[model samples]
Target: MKRGWCFLLLWLLTPAWALAAELTGVRSRADAGNVRLVLDLSAPVKYKIFSLKNPYRLVVDIESTHTSKALSMPTTGMVKSVRAGKQQGGDLRVVFDLSSQVTPTSFLLKPQGAAGDRLVLDLGASTTPVKATTRSAGHQPQSKPKPQRSVVTRSVRDQPQRSVVIVIDPGHGGVDPGARGKNGVREKDVVLGISKELARLINKQPGMRAVLTRSDDRFIELSARRRMASKQHADLFLSIHANSFTNSKVRGSAVYALSQKGASSAAARALADKENAADLLGGVDLRGKPDLIKSVLMDLSQNATQESSLALAEKVLNGLSGVNKIHRNHVQTAGFVVLKSTSVPSVLVETAFISNPGEEKVLGSKKGQRKLASAIFKGVQDFVELDMALRLANAPSRPEISYEVRPGDTLSQVAQRYQVSLSRLRSVNSLRGDRLLVGKKLRIPTVAGI
Candidate 1:
């Protein structure tokens, strides 16, 4: 981790003229099973709204506009708080913090008698059919302190660490279908299908395990994706995507590394521009971020990360060229949001062009998806093994043992039985609760060189 991470490369301020419309006022009305929020605008505009789960939130994004200072956000009728902000490229981002799951419907109304143009939103809890998978709102997970006991360990030499961890991100999901093809192929679905295959192959390797940013079709903000990768301290972050173009004739597989100097090619620039809008399409609040920006650390990390990214891009490109048509003989560069991990070396792979009719058919088929997955799996495994082989040569190999809990045994007792710290057991296995379920298998970590 780099020090002095106070500088964050975020959106810059826009000028006055760029702020096109004036947000005049906001009002609301309430009734049983329904609540309406009306925003008076100086002009009619285009807008979109989407709901996010795992802490239910409703987000609204409007066209070029400025927020109204006099606009009052009412917390009545299932609304928690309404936060409005200026987004990059002269757009207005409004986020409604919700108390529970609510179906949101928004539409524009023409100026009527005694009223200006209005963007009316209806958020009704009862009208929305709650899904079984919805996590309870404000449900805080409790982690009890484990009972303490003495833990003994057999003396051993330096222990080798765990396998190299990779984070795989299948771009755009849920409401954001990503780029769509004429044949009904969706970018989100295609990438996800390929990513799942890659994960299976990576896990089969001796020293590699892959963690997905999202295991299912769900929306995860670009910021949260990188945050998850950093939290895991992943060795690499690979984002799988399908390319698209308005022309519909362009088709090929390409690999990209991040570039602070802008895009290397016009197509790369356009694709990055489209992909960067994913947060907006997915209804993510731009203002949600860390408190401090670390400029010096960010710069240092970017330089190193880009270097490693370029190397992986080269290797991956080679593997991909054999399986698919090469978009560019050399790796390309772009500002991909999901590839912006400071600590992890990241690369974004454009498997093929979804906009191209012929390529779309190939990518949509299971055979095509598996071929792409196998190419990516081989590339990543080759690169990671070579990189870590020298480092692991001197370290003792870590052998994970699975222990099934018996009756009358606590998690602490299990840790003691394995001569490992309780925290180590939990961290390695991603345990949340201290409660032990008999016959549940727990992966025990070795203490020699952990």
Candidate 2:
């Protein structure tokens, strides 16, 4: 009886992490000089990978994971052979013998549709011999090779600026096919077509890149769409959607920014409620999402971000005016879940009322989609240029020294004494006249490093 009690105590004291995750299967695909290996998992697991020299092998160690007996290995391409063994402390180690020295890239993907959690590893042949290096899961191994200098030289002023990333989201898909028109045109189909065209146009411009939340007909949660924009460090977030009304006569385009203090109008409030219900229709549970409410509250304090969003909405509204009838001449505000991003300026563009037969036909046609995409692109271009100008104007330059004017001091004298241009000094101080009043502060700009 005492031995039985002791066994029970030992079992109860064991840690929950002692339970292992199962590595269900292994699959591989081979190309000309590269090989891709996919490991199917019953649950997500922590992993580490490293290269081995002198026989050239790659080792992968997954923590608290056990390999299934049916797991298979590949024998072709960069990988010559594969072996699996148990490591200390309930870890599984898989080693790959390579035919040649290779660089490895890896990433973990969450479960989607019929697939489970997956760990993907890609091995590519390297020209030079590789040094053994260790890396955590989903990270590329760092190379020790020194960077080479460019053959051509250029001035610092000639360097290109960083590209602005814009995240485009097409609303509703899959089971939740948004609004439908009399002609059988679905909102999902129309907005996706327009979003793709917008992405194409934005990519063609210099110093701008576009990323889509969903390129296909997949339903993404409203909060997830905003999170995607934040993940991309996006400068702007545009949610493309087609509006619908109970009355088929209502037809026009509209732009909206998020407002924490209720909607601007009754129609805007109803639309926001309809849009927010998409999560429930798409089977997304919002019960445990306190972060969503927190994000909305946080956005309320972000006045600069809200102002930028309003400015962006105005520009997009102006652009829409050129393509179709304006639903509202001014930009509207509502409590849209997708526009609650705290950092990125976000807006939702109602392309047109899908319920209207006349606009539905235009939305379904290729020519109409292109025209709308072009208008939105033009608006985005205008906003980006204006934003860039404001940033440049506000950017810190050469330091300035505060000088109080004396009885006989002149503006030109201060400019000359500081070795700064008189015009630049006048511009910096916003002085319309050159006369300096005694006892008044004068900002004298100084050259950097002088």
**Which candidate wins on lDDT?**
2
Give the TM-score of each candidate.
Answer: 0.53, 0.52
Candidate-wise lDDT, in order: 0.71, 0.75
Candidate that scores best on TM-score: 1
| TM-score, structure 1 vs. true | 0.53
Model 1 clashing residue pairs (backbone): 5-293, 5-294, 6-293, 6-294, 7-293, 7-294, 7-295, 160-396
Q: For residues 266-349, what per-residue lDDT tens digits would candidate 1 score against the true structure?
A: 988988888878888776644354332222124524555667778678778888988989988999998776776456578999
Q: Which ten residues in a row have the lowest lDDT in candidate 2?
A: 147-156
lDDT of candidate 2 over 221-300, digit per residue (tens) = 88888776765556789999999998999999999998888899998999998888889888876656867657544454
For every model shown, the clashing-pair count is: 8, 0
